[model samples]
Target chain A: MTGRVPEGLRELLAQAAGEGHAPWRTLLKAGDWALLLMAALLVAASYPLLWRGGVADRAIVKRDGQLVTELALNTPRKYEVVGAIGTTVIEVQPGRARVLSDPGPRQYCVQQGWLTRANAVAICAPNHVTLQLSGRSGQNGAYDTLNY
Target chain B: MAPMTPSTIELPVTADDYRIARYAAAAIALTVAETALPSPLPGIKPGLANIIVLVVLARYGWRDAAWVSLLRVVAGSLVIGQFLAPGFFLALAGALCSLAVLALAQYLPPRFFGPVSASVLAAFAHIGGQIVLARLWLVPHDGVFYLLPLFATAALVFGAINGLVAARLLDLPAVAPAEAAA
Candidate 1:
């Protein structure tokens, strides 16, 4: 209590306590602004690293969460899955997959159209069928360590 | 019945316990209340309780702030009926990560870094930890990281706002004077 207060502590107290005339100036310190700027830059940088539209190598069809088949996207083909309700038709071409037709009432899966990017999914919930596109995960390489 | 001994029967509550309890209660209340507010997305939240944590860190110290923050997550999940559930673990992960960041951030030069800076850094850590956990346990897909920019933006926005609020609260004489003693 008797010793002199450090310059940093004094300034922080004065600014936060509103001893200054300007209200905005009291809101954030120089370090706070610097942190904010750095955070923005970091966020901006993540966009390229994370939002990747990887080309799918295969299409996986599932019924009731169980894998029905893995279709190579290189070969254009059509396959049918008999789900809970009725038959759902899936068509794969080159590097994309689409639901040609489904017994689901809403047709939301069909509306999803062609899913070309990795990890894209189309669900025919009424029929309990789902289609997902997967590619070689660049980060994970050829195998998932967790699988072993 | 015979009168109990004063030392054995009395609760071991101290000044620190009382302080932590007070702050923890406030943070827990805010955590529960935040759930009532409608969110556009599932994971995004204003994280109002973090304001209390930031203020406690700046005024009391990181230890008190850590206590308040961790307690809020545990108690808040219990109140919301999500204890031992996936959501609870997500919250715990986020809180733990943020506390770790605050521990380090507190050591930065005071002239440059303050409560606001610490709050922002903690916020980023919070979201980052959550995403990593979700990727490993819930989604199990690399695609999950795509949400980073969105979550990061939310962290920055809410973190700065909460930090500002904490700063304003610290302006009060009761809170401001503690910095010198601490």
Candidate 2:
């Protein structure tokens, strides 16, 4: 449809083309400043929903996306998980956990250093192992050995 | 000799077509170049090409801007060897969302809503659309939401920057209405 433009499309095109060439400032205009503020506020509001703070009370380990074991972080302990490639060693100290060693070549999980905060995770994808730390409010508390 | 019919039908090309092609080419160039820059995450990007879209929106109109933005996504992906791949769809999703937002944002009072405001709004919508698609298909986990703050921050920073660039481009005395494609 080279020349046959729909009425609605024509109107939209005209409306866009007809827009004024307004002047620009750093902040641009009143609505722009307001939008910036709103965007900041929106991002700020998402912090509570997306970010988890406070010390994690438990360390949950998974292999191949399935739960392997859950250990309390109150007691320092060393745990081993047999994974796709080899065993992954996880160390849990009071309120925190870390990957002591992993068979994965990259050692990304080992480099992660620590998972002290709630919802912290160390994933060794090559070994199909994942270690996640959870606080009292963390979602991982939904099921456990005691509950089962 | 009854009739000498041309093998191909010639469609009349308008000035808008040439202008749009030029704008789309510029946008695609930016997209391809931006890919060379290192990113902190796999998906998060500065979206520098959006500046061209903002300029097209202000100078040409929403229709031309939409054409330019979409053509950039498709052609850019093809140039980068990502056509019809996961990355292509993500780019397309972002472009569509931003265009939808810009369509409505255009109606707002120009006195209050200018290029910067439109840029910021489109940026947010762009990320939002990508996140939704990523969550549904790629990652398939709620953990995707964890990236919201980071992506949102990128959108705000890059969106405003692109908008400011567009504003400056619009203000240049040399920039006039699109001349018929040479």
Q: Mind giving the per-residue lDDT tens digits that candidate 2 earns over A38-94?
A: 988988887766674544678899998899999988667999999999999999876
Q: Which candidate is the best by lDDT?
A: 1
TM-score of 1: 0.65
| Stretches of model 1 off by over 4 angstroms after superposition | A1-22, A54-148, B1-8, B175-182
- Candidate 2 residue-wise lDDT, B69-160, digit = tens: 99999999999999999999998999999999999988889888778888999999999999999988886544567778899988988888
Tens-place lDDT per residue, model 1, A6-124, is 33234344555565343644767788888799888988887776665664678989999999999988767999999999999999877688999999888999988988777788889
For model 1, how does the per-residue alpha-carbon lDDT over B55-158 read when each residue is reduced to its tens digit? 78987899999999999999989999999999999999999999999999989898877677888889999998899999888865445676788999899999
Q: What is the TM-score of each candidate against the true structure?
A: 0.65, 0.64
Best by DockQ: 1
Would you list the clashing residue pairs of candidate 2? none
**Model 1 residue A25 lDDT?**
47
| Per-model DockQ against the true two-chain complex | 0.22, 0.20
